[model samples]
Target: MQLDEATLRIVAILFSLLIGGLLLFSWNSNRVNRELLVLGSSFGSAAVGIVLIGIASLGQSVIYLYTGVTLLFFAYGGGWQTMRIFERRPVKPWLAGLGGIFWLALSLIDPEHGPLITALAVAVVPASYTALMGFELWRGRGEYLPSRFALCMVVGLDSVLLVMRGVFIMIAASEAHRWTETQLTMTLSLLIVLVNVAVGYLMLSLIKERLETEQRAQTLIDPLTGLGNRRALHLHAERILRRQATSGQSVCVAIIDLDHFKKINDTFGHFMGDSVLRTFAERATLKLRPVDYLFRVGGEEFLCILQAAEERDAVGVMERIRRSMKSYRIGEGTEARGVTLSAGIASSRRVGYDLEDLTRAADAALYKAKRDGRNRVCVYTGDDTRLAADVEGRAWAEPRPQAGPLSGPQLT
Candidate 1:
């Protein structure tokens, strides 16, 4: 059974209000998600515009019709801005309102052809906004958002439907002059109700998915140094070791300790200590290869996993980091202090692919470096019997010449 024009419009207005209210409630729970609030207002404006247009249909008031059309323009523009805000782009209120301003200006200047212009604006303006929204979602597809593609598809379909409706109205201008009372307009109103519901739910899902992903990352990230924490270390190590086991490639674990960190803390204060940690992380990250993983395992302690690397390769990386830290001066001229770091590297060739075994071997070598001298890199050489001889041999133990800045891509 076909519904009458008034009934379809009333249904559209009610559904829009319901979706708007739900979005507003979601915004109330997470005020940081301002996109939700903006989208909700867009729906609210659409609902109010539909209501005014419904009343004008009964009274034949040109002023009310113009006001309602302008509001609808603003409503669609807001929808477009919502996508921009969701993608972390700056909002342009003037651009968002440009559609509404254009409609009002055209209505005032060309009152004779107001109906034709109104129908065209209704078709073109909303389609433009929906198309823009779809494009914005498409641009952000790299972010791993689940509902993003689906929402884009929905908005694309909405734009197509709007353009089709406008074309139909243009072809049948004499019949479409009573814009709100036309059969095509009623059909569009019902389609809009469905679109509003789908878009609202999908947008909320997108926001929720992103928030959950970030919260999970927060648990594994060191906020101070912006490095992976111990939890991330274990998570990444498992995958790296499994891959190494299959490929038969060497994986080196390097346990690093900042030399005289306690002295820096005791002398300069914890604030300065924090600064030192951040600086060390930054410098070490720059010196390391992109394939390597770095993590903060404890206070003034860090771990590096070098993929497909042997003891010599691991030692080379550690030495560069050691030298980088040694050259860096903290604070100003008089107060400036130099910092050094020591790293102990153990390879899967000797320690096996087990993360714990590698960590233990690297830790032993780290203490051995500390005992021999600080600011040096040491390689794990089997048990204690071989350790002393290996240290004396200084085969791969001797420091290599300071290489130029690392050439390949650095870790993020």
Candidate 2:
């Protein structure tokens, strides 16, 4: 077709309709993303709005023109609403409707400058919302999805262009570029086509990226406790070891085994056992520092990588976790039973910076705690005297705590 304003408007309408249908198809493929629905509504409304505006030009019905343009304002509102939904924010459709009302009021007051007045009045809300949402997306650049960020930039730049166009019109003492051959009108037409393609691609990219991210996370996370799995634990251990070596800071690996966990599972059923496991994971995580990493490396056993200066700090951390679990109870009322945890800490200062070595030492100490009547914190001291003294082969490691002796549940 011809490249005149009317032809360009038709092209824009076609683009909006095609994009709306395609995005709606994508949305149907995965109805979970509500933002897709809102985004589709925006494009659908844009097409309808353009059609009405075109019809109003050829006809004398002011009502048709006003309704059509109001829908256009709603279209802009829909765009802003899409962003709000995408960001997991609250939706306020009324605000955009309010802008449409303002636009309608101005159009009724002065028909000659009505279009200009309407554009200027309702533009800020979508523009501002778009820019703000883009800024939020920009802040999340660490997500490593450049298309998502680029989409934000596109929206923000479009808003700026619209705002600048308004200012230029007001300052030049000229009529708005609705009918005229101006850079603003041409730029807008170009942008409409560009934005339609960009939005479709970026929205798809964001959804796919999020899905991949969640899938990757699920592989490394424990389903029952929501703690890191054995693989994740190993990865974290290697990272922690490198950091410790560079800083000359010692690290501690603690192996925490829930006392008689299998018995609890058998007595109370696996359902109750699962609840206790979740409770323990939650409580233990709260007890540890942000730098300390905890992982559910096995059934009823958690591994902790603590950034500590000395051996004592690791023991202290385990003590805190043990005490925290003392009050943690599953089941309600009269039948509520409390759970206890046993911990074994192996310090990098003694075991060197190897994860396997640290893990072995921690497991050894944990075995000692299990032997010493469970529910106690044991630490691996450099002296192998305690393990050698376990002549009866009661436990694998030392009987005493490496840092300071803990009066465990047996003492109380």
lDDT values for all models: 0.83, 0.72
Q: Give residue 256's error in model 2 in angstroms.
A: 0.5
Q: Candidate 2 has what TM-score?
A: 0.85
Tens digits of lDDT, candidate 2, 180-256: 43466556656746765676668777867877877887888788887788978766667768989999998888899
Candidate 1 lDDT at 357 equals 96
Error of 2 at 313 (Å): 0.8
On lDDT, the candidate that comes out on top is: 1
TM agreement with the true structure for every prediction: 0.89, 0.85
lDDT of 1 by residue, 35-132 (tens): 99999999999889888887888877777777887888898899999999999988987887898889889979998777778778877898998899
Question: Residue 122 deviation, candidate 2, in Å?
Answer: 7.1
